[model samples]
Target: MLGTICRFWRDQRGIALILVTIMLPAIIGFALLAIDMSRANNLHNDVQKGADAFAIAAAAELDGAPDAWTRAERAMENLVDNTTRFSNSGLVTLASAGSVTVNPGASSCRSRGNISWCFLKSLPASDSSPITSSNYATTQAETLFVQVTVTPESFSSIFPASFLGGSNGLTVGATAVAGSPGAVVCDMVPVFICNPFPGQSLYEVANSGQFYKKSLKLVVGSTSWGPGNFGFLRPSDGHGYGETDLATDIAIGRVPECVSARRIYTQTGNLTTKVKAAFNTRFDIYANGGGFPSKSDPRWPPAPNVRKGFQYASNGNGQGSGSQNPCNMELATDATRYHQLTRDTSFTGQIGNGGWDYTGYAAANQMTSALTHFGSSYNNTTNPPSRYDLYHWENTHDSNGNVVPVGDPNSLVHTQSVGGETGVPACASTVGDEDRRLIYAAVVDCSDSYVQSQLNGQSGAPPAIGFASLFLTEAVTGDEVMAEIVDIAGSRGRGTMENFVRDDVQLYR
Candidate 1:
C-alpha cells in the first residue's frame, strides 16, 4: 500500500484536468468582460449614427428664417426615430429645448435620453458653449451651423463587476455638428450686372416687373462705371482665364468654375474686344481667326433662332470663299437692309421704358399677336409680350403654325431674306442647347462701398446681392451687350439667387 501511494503522488495523468479546472473561472470572467465591452462598442456606434442623422436633419431647417430654430427643433423631434441594438434595445429619446424663446441651456424635454444643441455663427473650438436666443436672432444670417451633443447612454453590464471591484454598468456618448456651408451657384456666365434697383431686393423687383421685359445696355468699362454699367468677371479657377478663355466662356455660356453668389470677382482690365467675336457666334457669325471654332464644329453651334440684321455676304470680301458657307463673312453695313430691333424709345442713359417696336418686330418676324400666341391671360394692350416671350413661341412652333417637339427639326417660321440672312439658324438645325440667348449674370449692389471700390479698379471681391437672367436681344455691338432682364435666376420667393444654387448640409465632427 505504501508503494502504491508513492506512485500515485507522482502521477501526471489527471494533472491537465486539474489545471483546466483552476483556470476555468478566470477564462469565463474574461469572456463575459469581452462580451460586455462589445455590447458597449455596438451601442456607441448606434448612438453615433443617431447623432449624425439628428444633426443633419436639424441643420437643414436653419435657413436664416425667423422661425428657423423652432423648425429645427420640430424636425429633430419628428424626423428622428433611432433604436439601439444593444444595451436593453430601447427607443433613443432626444431632449428638446422647448421653444426657440426658451433660455439657451434650459431643455424642457427629458426622458430615457437627453440631447443638447446650439446654433453657431461658425465652427466652434469646443462644444461647451451654447448660443442664446437673442444672440441667434442678432446673428441669424451668420449663424449657419449647429452643434449637437447626446448624453452618454448608461446601462447595466452583464459581466459581474463585483469580481473586479468595479460597477456593473457602462456609458457611451456621441457628438455631431452639421449645417449649410452657404449656397453655391453653378454654371454661371462670366459677367456681373450692377443691380438696377439697389433700393429693393432683386426678387421683389423682378416679380413686380420693374426690370423684366425692359431693354438695358450692358456697357464695357474698365473703371468708374455709372449706376447702370455692366462688366465681365474673372473666374476664380486658378487655370487662368485669358482673353481667349473669356471669349470661349462668353460663347459657351459658363466657365468651368462655379462662383459664389454672395461674392463675385470682377475682371480688372478691359475685356471688351475679345468677346465680340464670341458673342456673334450665337447669331451664326463665326470669325476666321481669334481661336473661334469653325462653322462645322458641333460643339460651338449657333442658336436655332439666329435672327440678326445682316444676311450672308454675296461677295466674300476675301474672307468667306466657299459658296456653301458664304455666311461666315461679315456683310458690309446697309442701313436700309440691316434689321436690328429698334430700342425702347423712352430710354434713359442705359435703361429703357419697356416700350420697344413690338409691332414692327411681329411684322418682321411674321409672329402672331400676343393674344394669339400666349392666350387670353397676357393680352393686355398696355403690356405687350416681351421679346423673350416671342423667342420661345417662335422656337416651339413651325412655319405651318403646328406644334413641333423640342428636339425635332422644324421649318423656319418666315422665308429667308433676299440677302440670305434670316431668323432661322443655318449653322445648327436644333435649338437643343439650354436657352443659348439667356445669359446669367451676378447682380452686384454697386452702391455698396466694396462694390464701388471694385468698380474703380480696387482689389476687392464685391458681394453679389443676386443673379439676373438677361436675354441677349442683339449681338454684342462694339462694347455694348444689349439685353432685356426677362427674369432673375433661382426661385423668386425670398430673393433672386444664382441660376443653380446648391444648398446642402454635412457633418463637421
Candidate 2:
C-alpha cells in the first residue's frame, strides 16, 4: 500500500485536470466582467451621440422666443425616448433622467455683452468664471448653450459584485453650445438703413407695416448727423476708393466692415456715380422700349421696367404687345408682369404678393400720387386707391353704432401728413439707369448706444441688427431714396425672431 501511494503521488497526469476544475469559475467570472465593461463603454458612446444630436436640433430654435426653453427640452426628451441599441447579449434603452438646462444669452464662459466674444476660446480673463447649472439663465442676446444628462433603464451586470462592493448602475452626460459666429453674406449691399422701430422685435416691425410702407432717406451730401441718415460705408482703413471700386466691392459682397471695420462716410462726393454703379452691378438695363433677351447669366435684370426712357401705351400703341401699358405699368395690377419680374434670381424665395408685398406697391403709388397730383381729394373708393392712408375704407363700429376713428396707423409713413412734392425722384432719368429701384440695404439698430457711437466713429461698435431687401421705388433726390422695405432677411417667417444680417449658426463647445 505504501509503494502504491508513492507512485500515485509522483503521477502528473490527473494534476492538470484538478487545476482546471479549480480555476474554471474564476475564468468565467472575468469573461463576464470584460463583456459588461464593453457594454458600458458602448452605452456611454451612444448616449453622447444622442446628446449631440439633441443639442443641435434644439439650438436651431433658440431665437429669443418666450417658449425657447420649452421647445429645447421637448426636443431632447424626444430624441432620448426614441433611441435604442443592442448591448452585450440584450438590448438597452436610453432616456433623459435628469433636468435639461437651456442657457440663452449665456456663453460657454461668462457674458461679454457681444455675440462674437461668447465662446470659450475667445473669452477674456475677466469673464472666465466657469458656467454652472445654478447660474445659467441670462437676458443677454449673445449665445445659446444646452446640457443633457442620461441614465440607462435598470441594467443588471451579468456577474454580481456585492462581495467586492461594486455598483451595476451607470450614468452619462454631455454639453453643447451653439450661436451665430457672424454671417457670410453673398451679394450684400454696402448701404446701411437705421432701424425705424427701435426697442421692438423684427416680428413687431413687420406686423406694424413699418417694414413695408417706409422709405429710407439715404445720407448724402450734407444731411444732418442723425439716426436715419444715408451714407457710404468705409469698410476699410482711410477713405474708401471712389465710385467704381465701391460698386465692385459691394457687388461681390466685399465690404470689409461687414466682417470687422465698418465705417459710414457721409461727406463723400460723386454720390450719384457711386449709387448708379452699385445699382447697375445688380441689374441689366434695356433703354428705349427694349425687351430682355435670354442670356447665359441668370441674375441680370433685377427688377421689371428696369429699362428707362420708355413711354407707357396700350397694346399696339407701345413697343411690346401686352393688354395694358407694359412700359410704365404698375406691377401689382398686372399678375403676368409680376410673375415675370419675380423670375429674376434676386426675387427667388422672397416674401409678399408673389415676393413683393402690396403694402409696398401701394406706398409707391401713394408717393407717386403725392408728387403728381398734390392736394387732390383723398379717394377711398378706387380699387387701388390714390391716398396715403393705410386703413381699410369700410365703416368700423365699436360696441355702439357710432363710427369709431380708425386706430393709429401701423406705420410712420401712413401717419405723416400727405401734401406737397413728397415723392422721391428716380435715381436717373436717362435710359438704362432704372436699376436702382431694387437695392439691398442693411437695417441697423440706432437705439443701441454702442451702434450709435460706432456710427459716429466712436469706440466699441455693436453688430448690425439685420438686413432688408429695399425696393427703391424712386431715385435719390437731394438726400433721400424713396424705397419700400420689401423683406427683412434672416426672419424665418412672419412672426419669428430676426437673426442678425447674414449670420450663421455654429457649434462653439
Candidate 3:
C-alpha cells in the first residue's frame, strides 16, 4: 500500500506540470486577445472622433447648397476634402482617422417659417432615408444627429490581423448634432452693408419688416451720412419695398456705416435712348401765377407746380391697383429751360458743350405760394466734378457749407415742399452697387402669386399707404451640396458601426 501511494504522489507531481502547460497557452491566448481588443477599442474611439469632425464640416457646407440632393453630394466631397485639409494640418491636428458624409432632404426655405436647419447629413448610402431605432420609426427629420466613427484600420497599435484574420483593419463610428436657431441674418449681410441715418425710410426697419425671416439691416450715415434726404431698400431678394419707409429702415439695419456697395461701372450713362427721347418730346410745361395768370397746359399731366418738371409713367404690374412706377421724369426737351443751366467756369468742363438733356427747371420768379416752389440750379463751383454729374455729396453742400438744395433741377429728383423751397423726394432703390449703402425690401414685379396679400400690411400699398414705404437693402448669393455611403457587417458585434450608435441614446433632428 505504501509503494502504491508513493507512485501516486509522484504522478500527482507531474499533474502540476501538465496543468501548467495546458493553462499557460490558454492564458496566453486570452492575454493576447485582451491586448488586441483593447487596442482596437482605443482605435475605434479615435475613428469616432475623426468622423465627428469631418461630418460637421460636410453638414455646414451642405447647409448652403441650393437643393437637398446637391447638399448631400457636396457633403460627401466636402468631407473628403476636409479630410485632406485636416490631414495637411499635420498629424498632431488630427490624432485619428475616420470619414464623414451627409444624407439630406426634408427641409425647404426653412426660414420661410420652418424650424430646423435646411440641410443636414443623413446616413451610409443616400443623404436621407427612412431610419428606425429605439422602438420608434423616424418618419422625417430635417437633419440627422452627427455621425462619428472609429476604424481599426486607422489603428497603428495593432500589427497584422493578429488571430482575427483578414487585414488588421476595423472600423467604428458615432454620430452627433448641433442646432442653430438660424436667422436670415446668415445669408443677407454679405449682400449689402447699410449706412444708418436718423431720418428717411431706412431708419424704420429696427421698427418693422419681416427681415427676421431673412436678415437684419442698419441705417444711413451709418454708411455715408452728410446731407441727403433719401435711401432705398431691397435685395434683388424681391423684398421690394423700394423707397418705402420700412424698406429703407431694414437696409440700414443690415450693415451700418458701410462705405460702399460692391460696385463696378459696367454700364455707363443714362436711361435707354428710346425712353430718353420719349421723355424729351412729351415733356410738359406749366406757367405759375408768377409767369402767367391762371394759364395751364392741358398737354401735361397734373403739375404739382407751375414751372417745374416731374415725370410720371405707368408701372406694368398691370394687375394691381394704382400699379404706377412713379418718378420725377426729366425730359430732354426741358434742357434749355430758363432757371436751370450750369454756368460755372467748370460748367464748360462738366457739360463739355453738352448738358443734362432732361426735364424742365424753374423757380426764381414764382411767388412764395404760387403754384408750387419752382427753382433753377447752376453748375456749382463749390463741387466742380459734380456740377453736371447729377446729385452727389459735393453738390449737396453750399460754398458756405450750408445744406444746399438741388439749385436748378439737374437730374429729376422726387420732392416735397417745406419752407418756400421744395425738398427732394426719397430715392426708390438700393444703390445696386456693392460699395454703396445696401438696401433690402420685399417687392415683387406685381406678378407675385400673393402680391396683394403679402404686401397687404406693407407700406406704399399702391395708394392706400398714401406713399411708397422705405426699408434697408442688401445682396445675397445662391449656393447647393449631396452624398451617399455604405456599410457592411458579417456578425456577432454591436451594430458593428461606430457611425450609427443607434439605441444607446436618443438622436436629435
lDDT of 1 by residue, 1-509 (tens): 99999999988898889999999998998898898888888888888887888789888876654466667778887788776667664556544435343343543212223676767666545656543444332344455767677777877788899767998876788888788654456777788877777666676686786777788877765666654677777765433557787777777778667776545677755645558877777777766543464566565677767776654544545322345563454443542344445556676778888877655554544443422544434432356667776676666666656676533456343444334455666664334352777787877777666568866442456767656777888876566778887666556633334336666788877
In the range 178-267, model 3's lDDT, one tens digit per residue, is 222111221121122111221222214223431111212222212221211112323332333323223222322342222111110010
TM per candidate comes to 0.68, 0.51, 0.27
**Better structure of 1 and 2 per lDDT:** 1
| Global Cα lDDT for candidate 1 | 0.65
Q: Stretches of candidate 3 above 4 Å error?
A: 1-50, 61-66, 78-172, 178-183, 186-439, 442-509
Q: Residue 306 deviation, candidate 3, in Å?
A: 24
Best by TM-score: 1
Model 2 stretches with alpha carbons more than 4 Å out = 1-31, 61-139, 142-156, 160-170, 182-184, 208-210, 213-216, 220-228, 231-244, 251-272, 280-305, 309-438, 457-460, 475-478, 491-504
* Model 3 TM-score relative to the real fold: 0.27
lDDT of each: 0.65, 0.42, 0.27
Per-residue lDDT over 1-509 for candidate 2, one digit per residue giving the tens place of the 0 to 100 score: 99999999898888888998999989899998998777666666665565556556555545444465555555545643434344432554444435533245453322111111112213223434554544444432433454333333345577777657987654444444554343334445566666656677566777665455443444542323344544455444535356655655544433545442122332134456445534543333222243222122233333223322122333554333344322233222243222111111122112222122333333433333332232243322222221112222211222222344432222112222111111111222322222234455555666666555555431223455555666554323233544555567565333222433444555545
- Which residue pairs collide, candidate 1? none
- Total backbone clashes of candidate 2, pairs 3 or more residues apart or in separate chains: 7
